[model samples]
Target: MPMLKYLIIILNDASVSFCHYESAKTGKKEAGMISYDNLNKAVAFALKNNLKVNFLYPRFRPGKKYEKLIEDVEHVKIVPRKLGGVYSDAITVLEAGDLRKENKVTGTENIILRLSSPELKILPAAVKEIARKGGRINLVIKDVENFGDSKISEYRKLLAEISGLLIKKSGENSIPEVNFLTDRLMLESMNNCDAGITHLTVAPDGRLYLCPAFYYESGENSIGEIRNEINIKNRQLLELKYSPVCRICDAYQCRRCVFLNWKLTGELNTPSRQQCRMSHAEREASGNMLEELKKKNFKGAKGIEIKKLGYDDPFEIAVKNRYSIQEFKNFNS
Candidate 1:
């Protein structure tokens, strides 16, 4: 049996976004206290499974009763550090204010900054300050479903503006890494969000979910009780091979989100055209960013060669590759 090595438990209403893109409107009620009975039970489950647990927090205060439980467990909180004192890698909820003044992130923490179309265009300024902080930055686009061929050119131009800053750092021997345009260049294979494959999430109700959003979007989607045994149907569908667009895709940086897949396509296995094109634009941007660095005599990253791809969507190429999508599933199975 394949064992789950990581477990995520949500404790509050306003959990941290971490490195993932969070939906602006999550239809969840306030983060109520799970009976200490349940919290202890969940921790015991993690201890028995040999899993690492990361706890999620809300903006509202956690009662004193919950403090000792927090101290006892090994978990990370995702909250907005700038609002006051709540810390532990704040999720940059929006990009509306002075990038540096609004977010003077300490040098040793991680940040998840979410941006819409207009906000992303102004990312060059934020990227420079973030790189100077000596911490990692992940840029999450809010409206990927809106990206199409008409907007592809605009996205590429924005990447050029950001890449110019990144390439200049090469001269300084600085590794200013940005998720949208740089991560793909360095990843050896797929770094997709391992939703149902490797880990599971436990909601405040003490039920297991594929990830947080699934638990919040519709309560009925909960997988199973986390204490005794866990069960899932169509488990293979969560793997890369079952995804037609992602299986043939080389944009290893894309999340290939399972919840987003269900939301857009109604089928967990199918990927939307918008998602594929947006990721391809990102992949192409990284390719161009690499070319800019090479002019300054910047060598390659690791052993992975990021070959320039001709088309943005791999499904288009899958039509031409002798090994169709059917063959991919066969090999993985």
Candidate 2:
């Protein structure tokens, strides 16, 4: 079994989501908090496994007891912007609508901006606004599963615009770290959301899930109880080596989200057309940005190159480059 390095403890069923998945609205009356016993067990489990914990919070402040237990270990707090006043040091999550409202950004806070495809137009401006405030933004396209050709084109165009801004910032030596664009430039290998491979989630019921999305989508999809052995069915399918296109492709920073994979392609190892296209758009933009930065003689642009690809979607090339049985085995080896 792969060593589990991180544990995402969902403090409540209504915990604010920080990724592509949607959680119950914070103000919802129906909420389920993780039992104190389960939370204790989870903490113990983390200590035993030497795992880093990330506590996902809801709108309401956790009681002193819960807060005390959380502080017992080193952990990251992921909370909604509304709770920012309470957990001032936490990584904040903001919806697209929230961007219009005045909010305090400490210039050091790592912010996650969750927006849909139609909201892609808001990103370049949002990036500039956040960067001006000295804050870093990581964008999550919440509706990536719905990215058709039209939306993909819009996303690609917006990325080009953002790339131009990033290139300018690079020249000024103030390049802001936007995940999709900058992350790819820095990474040389796949740095995906390896849920079930590198990390797992502890839901309100104290069940182990591949991620919070699996728990929200269906409880039956859970790997096992937190106290028991994690038993992810067809576990190898979750690894990079098992993903044919992903293994060969170089969109290094793509989340390669398994939840989105299972939702859109119905196969954990098979990436959807939407995901491939979206990631490639970002990849192409990153390449352009790198070239611009190199021309400006940016210090960090040395030795990094995102090669241009003939096709935006790896699926196009993957189909023609199918591996034989022995070749597949050797690749995995």
The lDDT leader among the candidates is: 2
Q: Tens digits of per-residue lDDT for model 2 on 1-333? A: 356798999999889998888886644433488888899999988888888899999988778898899988779999887787676668888886777676434323579888888777778888887667666788898898788988888888899898888776664444778998988877777888898888999999888999999999999988888764677789999998898878778898799999989998898888999999999999999898888887787767456789989999898887898867777777641
Could you give candidate 1's per-residue lDDT for residues 178-223 as a string of tens digits?
A: 8878888788778887787777888777788898878778779998
Error of 1 at 71 (Å): 3.0
Q: What's the true lDDT of residue 332 in model 1? A: 47
Clashing pairs in 2: none
TM-score of every candidate: 0.86, 0.94
Worst 10 residues of 2 by lDDT: 100-109
Error of 1 at 61 (Å): 3.8
Model 2 collision count? 0
After TM-score superposition, what is the CA distance of residue 235 in candidate 1 from its true location, in Å?
A: 0.7
Once model 2 is optimally superposed onto the true structure by TM-score, how far is the C-alpha of residue 138 displaced, in angstroms? 1.0
lDDT of every predicted structure (CA atoms): 0.69, 0.83
